[model samples]
Target: MTPDTLNFIIIDDSKLDCFIADKIIRNTGKAGDIKSFTNAATALEHIKETPPPADAKTTVLLDIQMPVMNGFEFIEAFEQLPAEIVGGYNVYMLSSSINENDLNRVKNYHSIKQFLNKPLTSSALAAILEEQAQ
Candidate 1:
């Protein structure tokens, strides 16, 4: 599956990071609608209030560090949502930190598809697409 066929939701405290990720995803050509939030709580609210279309496959790019609700907290809340709602999306944790503890903690969350390094890249996006295609 190509990124063009998937919707993306980017949650990061850094507005600049969100912009960069949005730009990278858009460059893929025909990419689906992309929404970004600097606050994890707001993002979660949006997810609850506005569910994606039934046929849409949504991928969430979440940052590990944030002010109020961190990525782990966000995942915990997300997991509380209905299974049907949760099943429509895949979550990826993005962090520049190489802390072994952080990495290990990420492994505890079954909702997280993978932990990616900071600065979203086309190659990483492509890899996600390929993995989803399986």
Candidate 2:
């Protein structure tokens, strides 16, 4: 599928961060429908509920910390989701935390596409979309 067909999800406790990510992804002109969530619990449920098209491409910019559920918790729940549903999208951790432990923990989840620092950039979003094209 092409970039226009892609659907993205951004999970960050801070609404401002989510807005920034959304803007950057759009500025890259590679994203179509990008959804942002403040909590992982709801986002996890959304991912499980909505099964994306097989050929469709999607990306998720996840935050490391949040109320109720953190990014790691999301990954755990995300992994439990059926492959047919969760495998459709690529997930990346967008965090401001510089803790090695957090980074190492996220790495444990193979599904994580990449680790992005705060203030999502266009280049990162483009790279992710380009990767999904392949």
lDDT (0 to 1) per candidate: 0.90, 0.82
Off by over 4 Å in 1: 1-4
CA RMSD per model (angstroms):
1.6, 1.4
Best by TM-score: 1
Expressed as tens digits, the lDDT of each residue in 20-82 for candidate 2 is 888887777666788989888988888878878666757888898888998888888888888
TM-score of each: 0.94, 0.92
**Residue 94 in model 2: lDDT:** 82
In terms of lDDT, the best-performing candidate is: 1
**Residue pairs in collision within model 2:** none
> Where does candidate 2 stray beyond 4 Å?
1-3
For model 1, give the 10-residue run with minimal summed lDDT.
1-10
